[model samples]
Target: MNSSLLLSLAITGGLVLAAIVAYNTWTLRRNEPKKAQPPDPSAPSAPSAFGAAGMDPLLDPILRQEPSLDGDLAGSAGASPLEGLDRGQDPHDHAIDPSDALRMPAPAHMAERRPGLDPLIDVIATLTMEGVVSGDAALAAFPPTRRAGSKPFAIEGLNDATLTWETPAPGQRYRSFQAGVQLANRMGALNEIEFSEFVMKTQAFADAINAAPDFPDMLQEVARARELDQFAGDHDAQLLFVLRARQAAWSPGYLLQNAARVGFVAGSMPGRLVLPASTPGMPPVLTLGYDTQAALADDPEQSAIRDISLSLDVPQVHRSEQAFARLRDVGAALAQAMDGVLCDQNGQPLPAMAMDPIAADLELLYDQLDARDLSAGSVLARRLFS
Candidate 1:
């Protein structure tokens, strides 16, 4: 039992214990799954940021696109640039992509164009003059001067400074005579009957003024114009949903910060947020704005958000139903999350029942538009609707 012998024994026992612990640890680690390493910062990320077909806004391309007008404007006929829907194609064959619908179209100049005058103009002129007047007789008429609240129509060479279509002085003699139908008025397109009356009046004036006596069938022209006007009426709607916090006033900073998480970006207008379209230059399908004066307060750091609103521009968007549904869901979610009231533009609360009629109307309009080869939110539709 010497002290040196005892010390050696203790050291050996300690070494044996350490070896056992190390071996157990190695075995446990080998059997267990390895912990995942942190992702490589420089490596490309999975495509989770965007949805299938690049629908998500987060993955929107940096090279933003405006609605393409090339094919429509250039008259590249045959297959339609709009996939799934053509003049003769089944309208319900495809779903309008949400992302695509949200994108704003180029300004009218950027898209397909029709001549200012209707095709029937030349025909009317030729028949009236019996080939004496050039087929380009519409050119003789001053282009309809569009005055706010005034129904302007092309007057073929009627140069009387005092004459408005509303009151063409009867028996007034002029070097040139009024001809053709009044195409459109300030309110909407003229129906067939209106055009017929216009034709009669113009013809009478032609006779009184010793102008050409021939008349052209304006029924077809009137029908086409009526359809165009009807389309415009159906699509010119603007629907709005409002949210007002039930608790404390909203923090603008927090609201703006979280809004981006849900896909809204700073809008062009101050105190507004916009859901931009997939096409870069097209107008946004959805816009949200604040009602509180704080929104426009000079202070850039103002955090008060007393009221918020969500709006859908019907004509500008492709699928009204989808847009409406998405808008409703998003508005409801935000309202619930923030303890707010969900209401319509009139401040009346909206229940599930309220949306049903709206949805039905949307479907009906969509069907009508489709039947006419004017799909909602398409370039041609947009132009005609506008």
Candidate 2:
């Protein structure tokens, strides 16, 4: 054989062997089943911050941040810096979560649960004397005359106190206390004068009964009261509209249900409806009901109905227009519901045109108060009014 022919044959044989090996490897891989890759042990697992309900609404915003781009947060730090901090914190810690701050503690007075008294007693001045007296006595037995707007007062016996005692059977024997008065509670200054008169009148009663009486210096209290009253009158002067049942009387149950529909809750007094107070012990901005009696009786099932009145504490609200408008609307609804007529202090019926002037006046008054930096129904207003 020639040398070149032999070399070509050897090369051809080598190429055939290589092709056979490649074919065999392909067939083996095709026949075998594919196996899944095991999870990487090096990757960290994410901790779930919520239950089956999924992410909390408050946390959704924070979690929505995308960390993919440039390996940086999408925005500034979100949520509280101490979102996942342990709740058992030190008492002196300054860092309070916003959500936790929302939950306010109850007031000291409410925690003590002081017994409630007749709201009339709170609003009115009261004078009491313990001795043998009659419950059925007339107002003539008292000094101050009963009038309207300017000077109004009431006289009743201490029969209510006798009933307060735990021991029974002592109807009028040992509990022979007499003479209680409900003086007007409009303002501190006016009440000062009313209270002084009350003190003097009680002195006369003591003289008549040959009894010694304890009295304080009237001049100082009166002066202080006058100052307080002046501050209140300048800031807390209120405008109100009265609604009375025109033909038939309004039931207490009906009144409460209707008032509640308009967002008026049970007030401090029986016959009163009030919006939420600005702060604890502060008077509500809006109040409604009758003057002489409570809005509702202690026992609604066995109580008689009387005339209903609605009033608004103007200074107690930030927006006088909104407050006045809401009151007017609510009053109109109540009047219509109870088959009553809206009126002024007198029996004269109120027209729709009447509210316009009142609204304007409220705006002016609100501006005045705001200018003086003593917004009505604010902490300052409440302090002065108080």
Best by TM-score: 1
Q: What's the CA error at residue 165 for candidate 1, in Å?
A: 32
RMSD of each: 18.2, 28.9
lDDT of 2 at 264: 56
What digit string (tens of lDDT, one per residue) describes model 1 on residues 1-386? Answer: 69999999999999999999999998865433222234456865433212322232322434232233211111111221121122112222321212223223322222222433234222233213322322233333333332212223434443244332221334442334444443332245655555555555555545543466555566666666666554344344445667866755665655664445456666544566666565655556667776446556565234456568776655456763377777777777677766678775456677877777666565555655555555656654554433
Backbone collision tally, model 1: 7
TM-score per model over all chains: 0.47, 0.39
Shift in Å, residue 87, candidate 2: 51
Alpha-carbon runs more than 4 Å astray in model 2 = 1-235, 277-282, 291-302
Question: Model 2, residue 304: displacement in angstroms?
Answer: 3.9
lDDT of 2: 0.44
Span of ten consecutive residues with least summed lDDT in model 1: 70-79
RMSD value for candidate 1: 18.2
